[model samples]
Target: MVVKNLIQHLAQLAALEISDSEVPKYQAQLTDIFEHMDQIKQLDLAAIAETFRTTEEENVLRDDIVTPSLSQAEALQNASLTHDGFFVVPSVMKDKDAT
Candidate 1:
């Protein structure tokens, strides 16, 4: 696709407000990026192993052990709101009646 049309389509899909003066600049940038991606895709990697990460780091998570003990009343001691047997929280939806 022509850069102008591609930029217009992308701007519409992304809900972006790009001025006409900025189209050429964005077009150049996107063109360069796609060119680099194309170069990378053209590389022959048949002999290379698939890699998910570039670094040689290993997982560093601590061992998980079951050693926690807290009653429901104790857990809700500092809460500002509570119902019968659960915490009462304000509705996160935009409207309380929305479903």
Candidate 2:
């Protein structure tokens, strides 16, 4: 039995804000989902064979062949910024010392 309080608690844990009017709506939906899961648990399927795939088609893969490609200079030709043979981008991480 999914209750309104439980739904509100779940929303809090997930960092979601729900209105007072939405609590009962979520509670009913969650209760129905749980009931369906419970019904699935009651089914007996011990004789059924476990299957990893439903389709008969097998994965077709191309042969791995090494090919000659671009040089270091060619690869970094279009970069907006380059430093010591490496592409220099803006810093993404914040400095820990600068609080």
Candidate 3:
């Protein structure tokens, strides 16, 4: 539904053709939205704090402790170039000294 008539409706809602100058007017709507959000925040949330959505459970979180991974030699066995116990790649610095 949105993809259809999106081009036609945009000019009507925006009061101007979609172009570089027209973008800021749409972005300025955010200021009006933040003003409304400020009004909602002023209300006392101390007592009537219920779960905002139907779900009331804390997000079950996993422990952040480390998980084991493959050993360095095993991981680097297939690399194109490696030396001094580490993977190597092409140097990003331009070789300006080369003639």
Candidate 4:
């Protein structure tokens, strides 16, 4: 087959100037694969239903349920400093007293 011939041609490419570790195995496989794919492309499918070619299966999902996130207070509960239900940190801008 043309694919096999292409694979053989690619395998022979290892003898070309390069490195000993270099091999065209993937290139050869790609050549063969594309040739095989060309066979599929050659099909006369004017009457075949394309949807039947799909392999999709039905999906199963869990039931939706109400969920709650941490409230502002709970979210900052582990903060090192808390003030009036909010996290407090040193002022990023220089305080006027420090200036």
Candidate 5:
């Protein structure tokens, strides 16, 4: 059974401020939850089998194949700004203390 004092203590532990009017509402909810848990505890499931997954679906992945890709020069050719051999982008960091 969920009592008013226990609910107040739980709220204090969780750093929550529950008003007097809300105490009865929370007390009823917590009691209902505990009653449902008690009903679950009385269930007989000794014949039930333990399984990890509910579905039989398997992952389908493709083979990792090395393919020819664009070169550095080709990649940087369309860039609006470029340094010696790399693309130059605007700085995004604002903190001076960032290393």
Candidate 6:
């Protein structure tokens, strides 16, 4: 794609309002990025393994232990409206024709 169209597309994707004067700067930067990607694409790496990550890091998750929680009375203490043991909430969505 042409630099001008690419810049406009990038600006739209990024939700940016670019001035006419800034177009050249963005175009130059995008052109450089595309050039680098093209250079990488031209590389011969048939012997290399596909690497998802370069570091040996793992996510540490805590044990799912049961614990004491707030009672029904405590939970509904700050509620404006409550029926039985549940909090009452107003309807958030309305019919389109109601407008």
Scored by CA lDDT, what does every candidate get?
0.85, 0.89, 0.69, 0.66, 0.88, 0.83
Q: Residue 59 of model 1: what lDDT? A: 81
Tens digit per residue, CA lDDT, model 5, 1-99: 678899999998876889989999999999999999999999998999888877876665678998999999999999999999898999875554577
User: Superposing every Cα of model 2 onto the true structure, what RMSD results?
Assistant: 5.5
User: How many backbone collisions does model 3 have?
Assistant: 0
| Shift in Å, residue 18, candidate 5 | 0.5
Residue 28, model 3: lDDT of: 62
Judged by lDDT against the true structure, how good is candidate 5? Answer: 0.88
Measured by TM-score, how close is model 5 to the native structure? Answer: 0.53
Q: Order of candidates by lDDT, top first?
A: 2, 5, 1, 6, 3, 4
Error of 5 at 48 (Å): 0.7
The C-alpha RMSD in Å for every predicted model, in order, reads 5.7, 5.5, 12.3, 15.8, 9.2, 6.8
> Which residue runs of candidate 4 sit more than 4 Å off their true CA positions?
1-20, 52-59, 63-66, 69-99
Question: Cα lDDT for residue 70, model 5?
Answer: 95
TM of each candidate vs. truth:
0.53, 0.58, 0.36, 0.37, 0.53, 0.55
Predicted candidate 6, C-alpha RMSD? 6.8
Name the weakest run of 10 consecutive residues (lDDT summed) in model 4: 14-23
After superposing candidate 6, which stretches have Cα over 4 Å from the reference? Answer: 55-59, 64-99
Give the clashing pairs for model 3: none
User: What is the alpha-carbon lDDT of model 1 when measured against the actual structure?
Assistant: 0.85
What is the overall TM-score of model 3 with all chains considered together?
A: 0.36
